[model samples]
Target chain A: MRISVQLKDFDIGKELKLFNNGDTNIGAVVSFHGIVRNNSEKSLMHMDIEQYPGMTQKAISNYVEMAVERWSLYDALVIHRHGKLLLGDRIMMVATAARHRRDAFQSAEFLMDYLKSRAPFWKKEVTKDGYQWVKSVLDDESALERWR
Target chain B: MIKVLYFAWVRERIGVPYEIVETQSGTVMELVEELKQKEPRYEIAFSDLSAIKVAINQELCEFDTKLNGAIEIAFFPPMTGG
Candidate 1:
């Protein structure tokens, strides 16, 4: 398992290749990407992501452990970018590998859902009016609860 | 002593993210009331319980739950992650 929370750009192609490793045993790999979107109603100038260092890593690692135990995944990769991010920025990526598609798919989705609701990261949007902090959506919480 | 954590708006409003408080065994609500008495900043930060959510160690929990041995208590707005 590899987890990275940093302020650097990532190449998906390179990441996928590294994950595959030409290992025949790895039959399935699932990946998900989260990008910054430009909305009409709220033109987001940028986003500032804040996190608590030790706690953030602990929280993410714990989530991954649960996913592996629950889904029988072989390996997983999670990368989340921090600092000032503009429109079209890659916010995060989750990849899971397993011997079967079901394990790969379910683990990938579960990892995303867990990260979406429980990750200890705060996003502040720089809007036209001013910097506004985003609120937690009810649906996000409900999505995580569904898995439990 | 339990370590309390505030995040995002709650942290900004409270002007800090962590505090170590000495308290006897009490419910989360009792801690909230005690926090409100600690300072005006906490009072304003926790004024709307409906907007805030508590977590015991990282799992979502209710404010009325007992905090007998909780090492960490986290307060934040509804999770808007993803």
Candidate 2:
């Protein structure tokens, strides 16, 4: 499994190719990408992301391990970026590989849910209206209930 | 000395990203109380305990969680990640 929390942008095409590793046992791959959005009609100037340096990686890796064990995943890759991001910029991505599509799909969803609810990253959005810290939506936290 | 870190609005109001705190507080709340007593900025930043979250050594935990040799502590708001 690969987990990266960095300031630099990643190449999805390259990441996928590297993720496959020519492993014939893996039959399915499911991936999800998260990008910066401006739902308020171009008002958003940018977003600044902050994270705990030591804890972020460790927390994500623990969840990835759980995903692999539960889904019997062949491989998994998670990349979450930190620092300044503008509208439409890819903020994060998660890919899961398993022998079956259901396992891959479900694991990817699980990872995404975990990231939304439990990850340490914090975002501050600067918009034409004003600069404010983004609050965690209640719905997102509730989304984790399904996994339990 | 424990390393205390803050993020987002907590850091903005506290005026520092991290600090070395010397404390004998047994629980997170005790430590918070001590910091709150140290400066008004800390008091303001931590005014609403319900809005803030705490972590001991990077693992999210309750305010009543014991310190017990923990080397690092962090305070922030609910995560808005991913």
* Best candidate (score: DockQ): 2
Q: Tell me the tens digit of each residue's lDDT in model 2 across A69-109.
A: 99999999999999999888999999999999999999999
What clash pairs does model 1 have?
A: A136-B79, A136-B80
Candidate 2: tens digits of C-alpha lDDT, residues B1-82? 8999999999999999999999999999999999999989989999999999999999999999999999999999999888
The TM-score of chain B in candidate 2 is 0.98
- Indicate the worst ten consecutive residues by lDDT in candidate 1 chain A: A50-59
Please compute DockQ, using alpha carbons, for every candidate against the native two-chain complex: 0.51, 0.90
In angstroms, give how far residue B50 of model 1 lies from its true place. 3.1
Docking class of 1: medium
Error of 2 at A89 (Å): 0.8
Cα deviation of A131, candidate 2, in Å: 1.1
lDDT of 1 by residue, B8-64 (tens): 899999887798989884899999999899899999999999998788876668999
* Candidate 2 interface CA RMSD, Å: 0.7
Whole-model lDDT, model 1: 0.84
Report, for every candidate in turn, its global Cα lDDT versus the true structure. Answer: 0.84, 0.93
Residue A62 deviation, candidate 1, in Å?
A: 2.2
Candidate 2, lDDT over the whole model: 0.93
